[model samples]
Target: MTHPLTSLSGKKGLIVGIANRHSIAYGCARVLKAQGAELAVTYLNAKAEPFVRPLADELDASLVLPLDVEKPGELETVFDAIREQWGRLDFVVHSIAYCPLEDLHGRVVDCSLEGFQQAMRVSCYSLIEMARLAEPLMKDGGTLVAMSYYGAEKVVENYNIMGPVKAALESTVRYLAHELGSQGIRVHAVSPGPLKTRAASGIAHFDALIDAAIERAPQNRLVDIDEVGATCAFLVSDAARALTGDTLYVDAGFHIMG
Candidate 1:
């Protein structure tokens, strides 16, 4: 089927949290590039520099910067760079979330207060920060998209702290959508089923979890990153203009059955 949205030929987008080829954010970047949007990218630190620099080069991104969301100044720096370079941004993709592996594997009741706060900071607060920073630069109005997981809705095994974080992230999507709607900006989240990613693999029993999703899901298989990317493109495009304050699932039809 022909894609309903206009090609993002002249659009400039900021993509955060691409770790490697396996990351969903990377998939989003690839598709967005193919769709002709100019992009800017960021990685967490020097450790990921070697991995992401080549990919940013491949996309011919306008800027590649280091960001540690926990760093109070980094968010402003990144957005300032975007303002300086692009002057205005058409869209942003937020694929960042983090929680201690131990905290995610343990019971929620046992989660450390520090761990909970850290999770909320990285996984939830970053979106709020991004929205606040991006709202001004989207002078003509734009889209902000984030990646979430089914764990936010149904408690999957060992997805402890992140479940709550994703839940809050989803809520942020709606609240931001309402607040930004006046400005014509759309805010939304994409919830995908379990897949093998560096981050997802941190969970205990991750393979069994993927296999379980495959077995029980209506599609009888795991979701793919490119599929998620395509859906993201739709969300950021004009065809989805009426959609906002929503969490759209790109999970291989897996989320509906069980």
Candidate 2:
């Protein structure tokens, strides 16, 4: 028998921002599917499709669509398909974030206006758009989970412009939770310890960040995608239904250090 708190059987979910097998989105998809939830996964574009499609297949995703959040119609298209195919949504895992290389490697003060705008749009605003599109589909009320990082709370070297952007993302989670709470919708940010991911690779000196995490974390180790996924799986389940608008760290106690 499945435990009601952990089992996701019969629930339908949409996962955005899967770039490859190593993506956090993929990890969440893996666990969610394992717990019996049906999923709809998206790739960024044709270039990403080849990599993401196979993983989606492995998860037995009911819908594998292209979703370039920056593209005008693409985001809407994915939700449209979900409504047409499943008529409702149970949860959404948003794991996409970006910043132009120039802005990312430079000091936050040196960040160009264009770069700042682009980072906010892709990394922060996209979640708001996803929540808007997801609201109607989450008829029975659902969850929205966004990936965040420890840098959002405290400055981390080389994290640069993304730090402020993620701070905004965290704030968005709180506001969304408040606005959507009355309808039974829950929102959360999952901040994981440093790990080698395609997105993290864009940060300059990312290795230093990983090393620092391992040295300072209470567990004295970095958390893997699977560990992050387990935390997200709980947030997406009914066991965490009462929790919302909070940042849950899966960083092995690293966030608690002075």
Candidate lDDT values, in order:
0.89, 0.93
Cα lDDT for residue 201, model 2? Answer: 93
Q: How well does each candidate superpose onto the true structure, as a TM-score? A: 0.97, 0.99
Candidate 2 structure quality by residue, lDDT tens digits, 124-223: 9999999999999888999999999989999889898899999999999999999999989999999998878899999888888889999999999988
- Model 1 clash tally, residue pairs: 0
On lDDT, the candidate that comes out on top is: 2
Q: lDDT per residue, candidate 1, 1-258, as tens digits?
A: 335475778889999989998899998999888887899999999999999999999989999999899988998999999999889998999999888877888999999999899999998899999999999999989999999988889888878878889999999999999999999899999998886888887898888888888888887888778888888888888888888889999877877874
Give lDDT: candidate 1, residue 181: 97
Give per-residue lDDT, candidate 1, residue 3.
57
Q: List the lowest-lDDT window of 10 residues for candidate 2.
A: 17-26
Alpha-carbon RMSD of each model: 1.3, 0.7
